[model samples]
Target chain A: MDLSLSTRNVSGPGGDRTVVEVGGEIDVYTAPKLREQLVELVNDGSYHLVVDMEGVDFLDSTGLGVLVGGLKRVRAHEGSLRLVCNQERILKIFRITRLTKVFPIHTTVDEAVAATD
Target chain B: MATVELRFSAQPEHVRTARLVAAAVARRAGVDEAVLDEVRLAVGEACSRAVGLHRSHGITAPVKVVLTEEEKNFSIEVGDGVTGTGGGAGNGGDAASGGSDGASSGDLYEGDAEGEDEMGLAVISGLVDDVEVTTGDDGGVIRMSWPTTPAVTMP
Candidate 1:
């Protein structure tokens, strides 16, 4: 079975930050893909990222770990990683884990990309 | 009262199906719609943890899931078939000393899988209001339950 997670870079090369659009369920089965993408972007010097999760239908602890790991990777380079998500269910997981304090979540991609460190 | 039993190979991909079925059953059991997402996520975490344990022990047995709808509650039991996995705590540290299957994949994971395993359990506990974890020689079982309204008869 194909893992339901999908990710795409929506931003062009010249922007100060890269916007990655992610959709589908983020779970143990597909979180590796997100982790790989994040690692590659950080390696490629795209430190600042805005992950647009508006299309995500579900997310679990493993997916949260990947996001937290990504945040750590970017922070190592003195950069930040923000998320654009408004889904109550999706946001609940962050609140449950108290990770809302770690990730800067916004309703719009523009808001995530515009926020200062 | 109603009961549904599902068994599948210890694989990550199968976790999604388990969650879907659990939520549908929970809804039919008169669980609140707003809390359906919690049910789905909790089931996913429990099933995923079972699959991980089976894989870590090199066990070929499938993971077992049981959904029970009572008069005022919905419960899910996610059980693993890994026997003698040692480490009653199910931590990565003691998995290597388990039994025959212990050495199968221990070297590859070292302790990373254990960390994820702990985190998965933590997430499960957070999502479930009434949850229980028990580990013994027979293996481990995570039994989680949520309150429901009056049972709705199925069509």
Candidate 2:
């Protein structure tokens, strides 16, 4: 399984937020790449992040851990981390881990970014 | 109903392969989408735990995965030959504390971090219908089962 990650800046009413779109499977093998990207973004001063997980086919606990770590990193900087996930399978993971309450999840990138405003 | 067994090196990358295979097996067993998702995640978690255990004990054995399909249920068992060095006994402590907060107490991001092996098990228990863990001198085994006819539907 390959995890493809791409980042783009989205300017919304909430200001410019980096949207990281992830595709494919996110297991233990592929989560490190995501962790690296997220850590790099936070270290580079980009705190407001929207993880678009609509394209993600599968996600495991390791992937969830990386997302939680990213959320903590952004929160420490007084910023917010939002998630865009519409797939039921993908969303089920957050719900199972009880992370649905921790991260603001939206159906669209616009909604996720606007929530941060 | 068919039974499939696979043995792969206890490597992180093989965990993904094992998950994919399990998903395929569940799909062939006529499992619904929701149940299939649960199976895939649960299998991945089991494989990840097995790989971590093997690495911890410096054992270079292969992890064994067995999938059994029944008329009304699908079961998966992931086994590893590496014996526990008293580490598996304390694996679930941090994971138990991290419940419902999403801030997993397990240091999953740290490559060399020890303990917290039960972090994935916590998530697996929520996804599947039933889960059982057995550990002894012959390493560890995690068996998870899901009903072919799922009771929960995606809303």
Model 2 C-alpha lDDT per residue in residues B1-155, reported as the tens digit of each score: 33999899878988988988999988887688767767877888889878877886787878999999887888898887765444332344345445454444323433333422555776776666577777778777888877786445579
Top candidate (lDDT): 2
lDDT of each: 0.76, 0.77
What interface RMSD, in Å and to 1 decimal, does model 1 have? Answer: 10.5
Q: A12 in model 1: Cα distance from truth in Å?
A: 12
Off by over 4 Å in 1: A1-15, B83-111, B151-155
Which model scores highest in TM-score? Answer: 2
lDDT of 2 by residue, A1-117 (tens): 499999999897878899999999888888899999999999999999999998898888778778878887887898788999989888877776567867789999988887844
In model 2, where do residues sit more than 4 Å from their true spots? Answer: B30-34, B70-72, B82-97, B102-116, B148-155
Residue-level lDDT of model 1, residues A1-117, one tens digit each, is: 333434445443434778888888889888888888889999998888899998888898778778877877787798788899999999987765556766789999877766775
TM-score of chain B of 1: 0.78
TM-score against native, each model: 0.83, 0.85
